[model samples]
Target: MAHIHLGEGSFPLWALVLWTLLGVGLISAVVYRVRKGGIKTHQIALAGIGAAASFAIFQLNIPVWGGIHMNLTGLVGILAGPLLGALIALVVNIFSAALGHGAVGLLGANTLVNASEAIVAYYAFKTLMGMDWDVFPASASAATLGLSAGAFLMGAIIVISGVNGSALPRGDLTVAVAGLVGLNLGVAVIEGLLTGFIVQFLASVRPDLVGLTDRDTREETTGVTA
Candidate 1:
């Protein structure tokens, strides 16, 4: 929002397509690796933070356009890390498309931008949490940092798409770029807060929900204390 052109470099249609393909391919590889690592640890909820958490996120939304909306993807990323987060995104995006939030063509781009927020949230918070104090910094930091970056990523795509697409008007593109960014600021904050809260909650209530988080904790503790 601060600059109309700020996001103009990221979301061209072809670029989005490429990004989606790359993400799917990359995550697929990670998933394979994780599967080989061993079976899932029980007591860890896959939907994370838990279904209650997802339900909680569903309750929050920022209205945009005549038909669009935005909310936090922070929890998903935090729980899944990039790879699993992207997988969750793929499922959610599919459902959203069926419900008319977006078309199929743009699904990849959406996942690319938003899922990164989750991955960032997961790792950033997960790492900070290692310092102790009950995940205070992880909770406080992930949402703000991850969502801010996610907002920028999403904003970038909208601008680039306008430049690349034959169907979009130049003026409309600029307006959308600025408007979405401004609109996204509040949403990003909410996302960040939500991410932090959820991370802390799960870490306390059901830490196993975070597959990647637990693994890292084990590795760090083992490496340092050993």
Candidate 2:
């Protein structure tokens, strides 16, 4: 079975390097694509929607599913790539923390958690798009899976940080675990619905986004992946 969390010793410099590379590279490519395309109106609008969603999630602090917080920033990650999603979450977290939403020192960790969600969502969404399955259902399902996995991973990382046993009252590890899993499951359903709607809308209105690859059926989801 996969380890629930990477141990302290497990957080080697190499791992951080790889993760940073993956995280930064993912975002850079998406930015490059948008810039290369000459900044279409829809892309800008999408950026705005993504930005607003990130801010809303960051500000709202309703504790649910046994102390697990629900944030649509996971959905933001699904809609946008890691870089922009992480950047958006960072901005939101910074402002929210300033306004007293979360711990100030925790901003870096928060960005890491939320950004990981976006990275997973971006790749999983793209990979599903590359497959032979029906576009809408496949991508939607993959998006949910990606977000859920990220939530789970993020929860584990917090535990590894020993915040579970910290004097700070974030809640016990068991309670925190339950909340994380619960939030992920709930968020999955929401993102799945949203993804289905958005992808269908894009398909109908902007078919160019899903261009054909060499094969009649096969298509590249992200040009940067290759």
lDDT of 1 by residue, 1-226 (tens): 0111212243565765776686577567757966786434442345544334443444344344422233445666655555656566666666655655555666667666666766777777767766653464566577567666766876676666555434658777667666666666666665566566766677777766654466657778889452
- Candidate 1 vs. truth: CA RMSD? 6.2
What is the per-residue lDDT of model 2 for residues 1-226, given as tens digits with 9 covering 90 to 100? 0012222233334544544465466446656865676554544465568777666654544455423344555456545555566666666666766776655555445556666666676677667666755657755776677667666766665555544224545466657666667766776667666766766576667655433233333444434563
Check candidate 1 and list the clashing pairs: 7-156, 11-157, 77-118, 78-122, 139-196, 143-192
- Candidate 2 Cα lDDT to native: 0.56
Q: Which runs of model 1 end up more than 4 angstroms from their true locations?
A: 1-16, 48-61, 65-72, 131-134, 163-175, 207-226
**What's each prediction's TM-score?**
0.69, 0.64
